[model samples]
Target: MGQNISFNGTTGVNNDTERRIHIPLYFRILSVIEIPVMILTLVALCAVIKSQRSAPVFVIHLILSDFIQIICKLMITSEWIREVDAIFPILPDAFDYSLIAGLYFMACVAFERYLLVSHPIWYKSHHSLKVSCVVSVIVWFVPLIFTFSKYFDSLSVPIGCLIPYPIIILCFVGTRRGLSHAISLTSLKRKLILGRLFLVLLTYTFLIFPIVIMWFFSQIFPQFMFSSFSDVLYFFSHLMFLNPIADCLLYLFMRPDAGDLMKSVCCCCRTDTHQNSTHSRDEHSRDSRATFACCVSVQNPASHSQTACSSV
Candidate 1:
């Protein structure tokens, strides 16, 4: 009777089980290092918001997403959670979703900077805290949809990952072009915007793009690559852990205090004495002008003094 009631062949299931790879010691070590960094980043972000009395809405969301991703990664790599993951395999999906959200938030930040540079008036009028909050909410939800759909269709995951790359590149290019023509933003402001955009682009290219490319290829040729190159894909996926650490640099770039510190450190060769000397020269020039005006006023009568002082 048991033989008569034949189940689906066991060969595919056995093959899949064999293909399952264990989390390496290196990834676990990386996760241990990442947790403290993410915590410090979160604290710094909150401190910046509190001290400045202004929240960088997109950056806040991006950091939150990174924190979530790091937590999910730690959960996945933890030995204690193996049984829970087997019972309910949701942590991996959660990690993927958080990663996607982080990508979107990065794009949002780049686009916001681009708007500020390219269309200052429009950005000033239309871009408000409320609008940013709404946009961040929307960004958070969009990934859920994609991650859910990814279970039904493998291609959806890669497509979702691929979408942000071009948006970021376009923002970086637009910002570079606008910086050349921008008159409203100061040199330091323009430099910060360009630097942030460049950093985002670089992060995506080096740390995130490899996993995306491997995922895309594995999805496209699942039978061939997924079976043959599963270990390679797993190795590339671990590279993503570096992203949250790299993201701390964004906070440094965003913080005014950090930027000032960086400038001071870079210009440490210029002595305080030189600055005092310049200040003294400026004071002497002002005093000389005042003396010249007083002499002119004294040389002329009251009626002519008004015209003479005005001319001086």
Candidate 2:
């Protein structure tokens, strides 16, 4: 997306020449970090797909989109594939397609949660796996169409990204308000739903929005934004890689057993305290049982009954 700005004119050409040595180094360093993360994301994707239990449809698509993104990004940044870019100039821009798809899926997830909480009857009756599948197909194609169309310029790209911003925000706010009145959801479920929405909003704002805003400005002030602030623009562009990693973590956080996983971690950290408390509880139970047995065996049963009732 920031490719145009990074290599636009004579000034950009000069800057590129100056940083020719450093750019490959930077990309290598990025690949080092991104490769492992990509592997981990792949492992997670396999696990999610193979499980017999059903996962939220949007979540699976979201992870798939992330995996595609990581692969595209690695190809785009790899120095060895510089030859491929020469033949297919559009190759470096491949990640944007998946990126936009991921954002749409993220919005879908937020909207689903919003409906689940805000309108339970409608969500329960109308929301189904088929509906989710159709929506996923549409989300994938919308970005594909945009990518092929001549109208999808720098300005349009930012506008497209901006389209989901308000949708996400509205869903988050609506869900928050709905939680107060939601009686069907348990307290833990409510918190997890709200948390997922919050994380989606947070990641989109901090990770994706900066590049979107940069693209918007680059369109409005081409020379100034690109030539004068090329380094800053480059930094904002690479900041996008973090989004896929965030998605992987979000997948883990959104798991049904995530709460149990957290509790187990907490227990592991407090083993000594728990053991001491358990021992004390066992001793108290034994003392109570012994007192009850002594009361039952007493000869003066009426007096002992009153005493046992008080002690027990």
What is the TM-score of each predicted model, taking all chains together? 0.75, 0.74
Pairs that clash in candidate 1: none
Q: Which candidate ranks first by TM-score, i.e. highest?
A: 1
Candidate 1's TM-score: 0.75
| Candidate 1 backbone clash number | 0
Q: For model 1, how does the per-residue alpha-carbon lDDT over 49-103 read when each residue is reduced to its tens digit?
A: 6667336778888878888876776665565777773632677677778888999
Best by lDDT: 1
lDDT for model 1 comes to 0.74
Q: Please, what's the RMSD in Å of model 1?
A: 14.3
Which pairs in model 2 have colliding backbones? none
